[model samples]
Target: MDSRLALAAVVCAIVLCATPAALAQTVQVWTRGGRAYSLTCYTRFEVVPFYRPPNATSLVVAAASPATPPALQPTESGVSTIAAVLLVMSCIIVVVKSRSRAKFEMIIGKNSNRKENIEELLDNYGSLAPKRYKYSQLKDMTGSFSEKLGEGGYGTVYKGTLPDGNPVAVKFLHDLTSNGEEFVNEVISIRRTSHINVVTLVGFCLGASKRALIYEYMPNGSLDKFIYAENSKITLGWDKLYEIATGIARGLEYLHRGCNTRIIHFDIKPHNILLDHDFVPKIADFGLAKLCNPKESYLSMAGMRGTIGFIAPEVFSRRFGVVSTKSDVYSYGMMLLEMVGGRKNLKSSVENPSEMYFPDWIYRCLADLGSLHTFDMEYETEEIARKMAVIGLWCIQVSPNSRPTMSKVLDMFEKSADELEIPPKHCFYSAIQ
Candidate 1:
């Protein structure tokens, strides 16, 4: 009976704590011992606690009273608002990410076909004749003819990435007015020879009206970028310059003697020389190359086939000498002199008469051996400069017969610089005067 009575009291207190009118009502209460109990009741929402005096032996329930809430409201509305905002942000992020991914996929899809075609060609050819590619495939390789590396009289070159992730340079031939002799010559000349110092023909494209050549991409690009410009992209040290000059000479020698037929590179200049990843020089651009019978000591050509500054005197007039491998030698010599001097061989708009012809100025400096200080060169560099000057003067002799052969040029490279004999100044000086 007593336990039931205590339980009833707790239930009443809970009701009073939850209801305002019930809490306001007061009720007299009795203990189990039949004693009147005085109790203090404290109520919080949905729960109540009672404090009893030491003399009290029973529980009491005060009438429930109306409860007033504190100023701070419930958190449900704020929580709902935050959840809604998060949902919208998440949806927006998903949409944005999807669009970005779709755009990237679309770009990849455009180039993928070209990559696949190039891979197929590489698989089939395996270093035979340069692989033939369709025009669409070339477009993909070159990214719609973008990223032009350079342009020449023949065509423009672009930088491209192969499907297999290898980089390549694509040379697109300009529309020709006459028969495509330049294209045919480049294909034939480069295809016939394979040497370390010679640029490799990676592939070619002859689809529809488009004609293009793909070559192994040279990372450092042409030698002229380093040689001609005062603020060159990459400044080559004297050692590197000498190494490039020697490599060019060796390449020319291989073209002359190593091939089945003697190949004369009618155009040899700094711009035609390309540098690979390690700065190894490779002779490139054989559009003007001529293949001759090994027995033929002289070749007769109808017209000149080289750059103006580097052209051999014989190529301009037969009065100088017969056009032969010696013509290439003469061109190589002019390029070598430019490499040594770090400037062009000829300048049309020069104010100083002595500086009008670079070869003459360099020849005068080398003859006296005292002008080395003017160049601000070190001991080793000074020696290399003198040797290159001596050999260059030898190769550019007015008479084609007076010029040393490519083989003799290589032999000279092997010897110490001190052992080289400076060629006597000839009609070249007189012509310039």
Candidate 2:
């Protein structure tokens, strides 16, 4: 009985500690035949002892229970998870913003360094350099960019008057990312040139975010307008055209030989040729010009630099030949043909598909007919046209070695049409092929 009573006490203590408050309250104890037993009684029971020993006692130890609370609610857990996610996202955003700001600041610093280098280059030239104007001064001169003269891929040209009342064409470059290389090229090349046919650079403007080149204004505008116009009021006769062609050749000759540093005008097209009031042709836009030693026959170019139609075969493909002054000669030849025909050298829409390439068509006409009688003209005009056509063909040979120098080109212009021989047909055939 003593041992049984001790076991009953131990079981009761365990039930009070281990069971929950609701179950502990329903614990029941009973004694039978001097033995004590404990049970966790609930609303339902499988069996009950009906026979009780004589003088047996029953004891029920009940504890008051409080309302049970859930271990963890769904809403509370969900809110905690969302807060943790938000905290992680915010940290990521801050890191990304900091990195972006650092990158932008680095780019600005590099651009600033480049601008300083350009300014130093200008300073080095001293009195020899073209006059420099402030960005504010340019705006005032251009009347807040009110009068736009023209716009191209690089920038816009505005007509402005200098303090001396001399009219100037201010070219405002829009692409700042180029780091002012084009501006530097134009200034370096044109400043060295002093000729009636080479357009003069009067001044320039450089700022933190702006760049411009000021040139002597040509009242007659570019050469393309006169050549390609349909019902144009400005009419240039064949003799005047021949004179213009000779003047351009002279300018090219000067650039190649007369200057201390040989300036190769890589881009020589109708659009780049400007005319004065008296209709005198001047070579303009030295942005693509390259300065080289007169002794160097070939130039090393990173990539093709001239317009598509005017780019020499060698400039685009190393398989043809090394790039040289002959490349400029090729461009001049294409432009000369355009001037003669009053149409582009390569045209998609033509009466005959075989005549699609103007140079080939002109070659065939010269070969078969011995004259450009397809277009009605006087004998003198026809003679001049035939001379220009033949000269153009000589300049645009597939192999650069075959093309004449600017000096030789000038000599060819001086000679009569009968003096010049026709270029090889195989040369023209290979060019078209």
Candidate that would win on TM-score: 2
Q: Which 10 residues in a row give candidate 1 its minimum summed lDDT?
A: 27-36
What is the Å distance of residue 72 in model 2 from its true position?
36
The predictions' CA RMSDs to the true structure, in order, are: 25.2, 19.5
Full-model lDDT for every candidate: 0.70, 0.74
Highest lDDT: give the candidate number.
2
TM-score of each: 0.64, 0.67
Q: Taking the tens digit of each residue's C-alpha lDDT, what string does model 2 give over 280-361?
A: 9999875433321111112324555676678888887889899888999999999898888888888888989977888999
Return the lDDT, model 1, position 395.
94
Q: Where does candidate 2 stray beyond 4 Å?
A: 1-126, 174-189, 231-234, 287-302, 427-433
- For residues 9-73, write the lDDT of model 1, one tens digit per residue: 56444443533333223211211111122122221111123345789767675644446353344
